[model samples]
Target: MTSFLDEFAQAPNLKYLNHAAVSPWPKRAALAASRFAEQNVLLGARDYPEWMGVEQRLRERLMRLLNAPSTDDIALVKNTSEALSFVAFGLDWQAGDQVIISDEEFPSNRVVWEALQPRGVEVIQVNLKGMDPESALLAACGPRTRLLSISSVQYVSGLRLDIERLGEGLRQRDVLFCVDAIQQLGALPFDAIAAQCDFAMADGHKWLLGPEGLGVFYCRAELREQLKLQEYGWHMLEHMGDYSRIEWQPARSARRFECGSPNMLGTMALEASLSLLEEVGMATVGKLIEERVLWLQEGLERLPGIQLHSPMNPARRAGIITFSLEGHDNQVVFDRLKAEQVVCVQRGGGIRLSPHFYTAPKVIEETLAVLHGLAG
Candidate 1:
């Protein structure tokens, strides 16, 4: 519907292009969160059942978003790091087992693997600067390699990997695959099933256009129980409501990973945000985002002393476009943009501009005009 595009009622002077970091929620999500707060203040937990319904819908939306087999494969976690820890600490690791990853991964992806070093598990950082990144990553999967962990799109450089290629290559080597999908999940179309990922996780606050502190984690069904439970509570019990029962086991579904009460406030907002994305359809969303990214790419390339750090190939990126001006320091440029009310971030040794599907053309034009002035 045409009305869906109007959901974002941002400031007229604001040129926000920082979805790769934290995004401002649309009007609908803000309203949903407001209404939820009112209900809590007036009625307390009296309508808790209805709140649970919203949570369920959130899981379903995430299930469809990830192309997961079922809602049973999805777990609402605190953030990407928590879900990564579930897989990092859950798996049984042996001495000399290697975990291969890219050299450009965010600290969240890299530090987790490196932590396993004390257990005699080596973390091999593979350079993806070569022509064929997938081949370089797979070549590192020697006989002792047990898993391959990578980000769907590198956060800083905005280099999108061929997940299908990596998935197939890892599968052939009998290696488990884990994807940190925070950068790609909401910017473009992603498939956990197609990628054959044993585990995948993403936070809601970034390109999902939702609030912080809530995220989704997907684990393949066959490997569900294989992950040893590190946390336990009433919520994760198979019989969650049996208050008087002593005997309990983890839920047979992915709910086993949820250790405590849900973040109901975050649930309401993210669910509403997801509804908007569903209405637009991810295919259309991806196309619109690519158009915007390409526009930024072209505009920045034409500016004097501009150099792009992100991939120039259309097929090799998502919504992010990182670039630098020859005469300007990254922090100084970032401060100038911030003072001008052009919301963007300095990352990957440059300024990272990420515009979403609903970003107005005027925003891009005006933001580029600012950069044009700075370039002069």
Candidate 2:
């Protein structure tokens, strides 16, 4: 097993704090991708059986990472948005049916729900700013509430919702619980089975440290045939390789969501990347990321002009800490951080800094120092 530091061959000049967007691939993932490319160059589909094995491993890894009921519950989708769309459009919705969501959701989560408005489905946006956001969301769920679609950790604010409570609460109501877990999955321990959620989706590009085009969508085993298939192709059939078979139906598992050819290259990278996280263990990963985020939070709190947008409590946050200088434009702060090689982004009226578990302490310290110096 390679040491975590040995795995990250990132340059010293690059203080990467942008995992919320795309992530820097670790050495193992890069090597996996290179090996895949080499196989394509030399042997091509002659070794296609081996590729299926890799894809199966990716599914198993995602299943374990999500604490899903089985590997069959996982589907390798292109991204979170695609998976979200499958749910947004597939559900048997009636006119006036409501879907609950937070106001702070990323556009992917927001737009998909809003698109359903033409069908007479109403999108309910609840503010998560107050002390009792979960209660507020639950309260908003009335007779017509069909689903409560929410992000596990808010993108810009790093607000980690109590998914278990929300799931349990919605379970008794006739409302389905769907979690967009891109920001929380790899950064923390997320259990789909434990939460009793109907559906969950997450991209691998964030804390998972994989390529951008790959993600996992976990729909409960019993609910597989429930989501009506929008896209269809040969790949999703149960007898996919048996072209001679006359009987055809979408797969009984969550693989039915995969409508076409697989993203083999992305699967190779994500599988290898997950190898590193499994070795570190999710609990350790969560603890390490929490420390880094808290370090940033505390430093920003001490700064004269900086104001925090993320929660002050560690339990309420996953792996993001956002802040802004009192007098500067968001773009200006973003530009300064970029110029300094302290990679960050401007979001939710502030600068969002997301550091992974492997991020060194010095990088966080230096980034904060540079930010304070610039503000001063």
Candidate 3:
């Protein structure tokens, strides 16, 4: 087993702090992908059964990561958007039915619900700037609100919401809870069951440390059959491999959402990436991420002309920290950082810095140094 620190062997000069956008694969993930490619080149599909085993392990990992009730609740989807679509289009909606979301949501979380406009479904955007965002969201939920779909953490502001609170609130009101957990799933500990979330989805590319094309969708066991399936194929059938079956039904699990063939290459990479997270344990992974974000936050505050855009309270944030130098244009500052090999991004009208658990202290120190120079 490789030491966790050695798993991320990024280039010496590259100070990467953009885990919110996309993540560099850990060494093990790359090696797994490479081995899968080599196997295809040598053996074709002769070892396909073993590949299915890898896929099963991936599902089990995702199940445990989300603290879901069972692997039966997990579905491998193309991405977060695809999974959100499943929820958006699957549910029975009436005209004037409402779906509540935060004003700070990434477009994926907002647009899918908004697309239901044609169905006469009203989408409410609640302001999360208040001291208690959860309270604001609950206050916005009226008798007409059918569901509350929100990101577990705001993409640009890095505002982490109390999902459990929202879950409890929604439960009393009988409103469905859907979480766009892309920014929170792998960076922090998540519990689908504890949160009582009806549906949740996340991509593997960011904090999950995997490829782009694969993601996980978790549907509560009771809600599985309630969602109308939009896509169909042999693979999603209850008797999937029995091609001779004249009649069939969708699988009695969350696998019903998967339309066709799976992304085996992505499966191998993500399974391997998740192995690292499991090895380190989410409690430690989340602790390390928060510590790094706080480190960056404190360091940014000490720099001259710095104005922070992300939440200052550690409880209100995750791994993201967005700030700006008063004297510097965001693009100009971004370019300077890019030239200096300080990889970050401009978002929410400021520069966004996102670090993973494995990010070294020097990376944060050096990034702050670059910002300090820009501040001057």
TM-score of each: 0.98, 0.98, 0.99
Model 3 bad stretches (over 4 Å): none
lDDT of 1 by residue, 81-194 (tens): 999999999999999999999999999999998999999999999999998999999999999999999999999988999998999999999999999999999889999989
Residue-level lDDT for 34 in candidate 1? 100
Clashes of each: 0, 0, 0
Residue 331 of model 3: what lDDT? Answer: 93
- For residues 1-376, what per-residue lDDT tens digits would candidate 3 score against the true structure? 2389899989988999999999999999999999999999999999999999999999999999999999999999999999999999999999999999999988999899999999999999999888889999999999999999999999999999999999999999999999999999899999998899999999999999999999999999999999999999988999889999999999999988987999999999999999999999999999999999999988888888888999988889888999988878999999999999998888989999999999998998998888787777
List the candidate 1 regions with Cα displacement exceeding 4 Å. none
* Of candidates 3 and 2, the better by lDDT: 3
Ranking by lDDT: 3, 1, 2
Provide the clash count, candidate 1. Answer: 0
In candidate 2 the C-alpha lDDT for residue 44 amounts to 83
lDDT of 1 at 168: 92
Q: RMSDs, each prediction?
A: 0.9, 1.1, 1.0
Q: What's the lDDT for residue 105 in model 2?
A: 96
